[model samples]
Target: MRRFNLKEFRSERNLTQKQLIAKTGIPNVTITQIENGHKSLSKELRKRIFDAFQVDERLYVA
Candidate 1:
């Protein structure tokens, strides 16, 4: 699976995966997998991620 540059975004936002998990209520493992491109997101998870990062959905899904 192709990875989204989630780590870059997080760095830009000065957030760690642990911080993101805390903010989004996503598990750390799930965040790790998403960052590593080992997992695809469900709609709900995607929404949470978007909310956490304040990013447009198109940026992620495209």
Candidate 2:
């Protein structure tokens, strides 16, 4: 899968980290780490993010 473009996605949606947390139920630090590439997207986190964005995972994976 390609890297999750958290920063770009958030920017496009005008969503702050806190707002994303509220929307996705992901912890703030984890979101920060993911955005900074310090962490990888686990299956569960990807699912949560996809659900929040209402996106299909096939669009992310080859």
Candidate 3:
């Protein structure tokens, strides 16, 4: 299965990391780590991201 690459998704939205944090309230460090492959998106944070984008969270799950 393909992992949900947050960086790609964020790029598609034309958003900067800081902008995403501001929009999702998920924190800059968390977004940075996730994007850098140094961290995984927790279930709660995953839900927040998908919900913020108004999409199905499952589609973005690893």
Candidate 4:
């Protein structure tokens, strides 16, 4: 199954969910949902997250 590596990436970056939300301009609930595998991000949000992490979007998708 495909999975998102949000939590892993965030940990590697030493960022908390709140910090990631602020940096990515994503809602806290959305970040939580994504981390918990309850929701997937929209393309735009994914791009924002990738930019915030300074990594390619593929890093988060599996």
Which scores better on TM-score, 1 or 3? 3
Please say which candidate is ahead in TM-score: 3 or 4: 3
Clashing pairs in 4: none
lDDT per model, in order?
Answer: 0.77, 0.85, 0.84, 0.78
Runs of candidate 4 with Cα error greater than 4 angstroms are 1-4, 58-62
Candidate that would win on TM-score: 3
On lDDT, the candidate that comes out on top is 2
lDDT agreement of model 2 with the native: 0.85
- Global local distance difference test of model 3: 0.84
- Tens-digit lDDT track for model 4 on 1-62? 23557787789789988898889889998889988989976788878887776776564444
Model 2: per-residue Cα lDDT at residue 24: 95
Q: How high a TM-score does candidate 3 get?
A: 0.84
Model 2: weakest 10-residue lDDT segment is 1-10
List ranges where model 3 is wrong by over 4 Å.
Answer: none
**lDDT (0-100) at residue 49 of candidate 2?**
84
Ranking by TM-score: 3, 2, 4, 1
Candidate 1, clashing residue pairs?
none
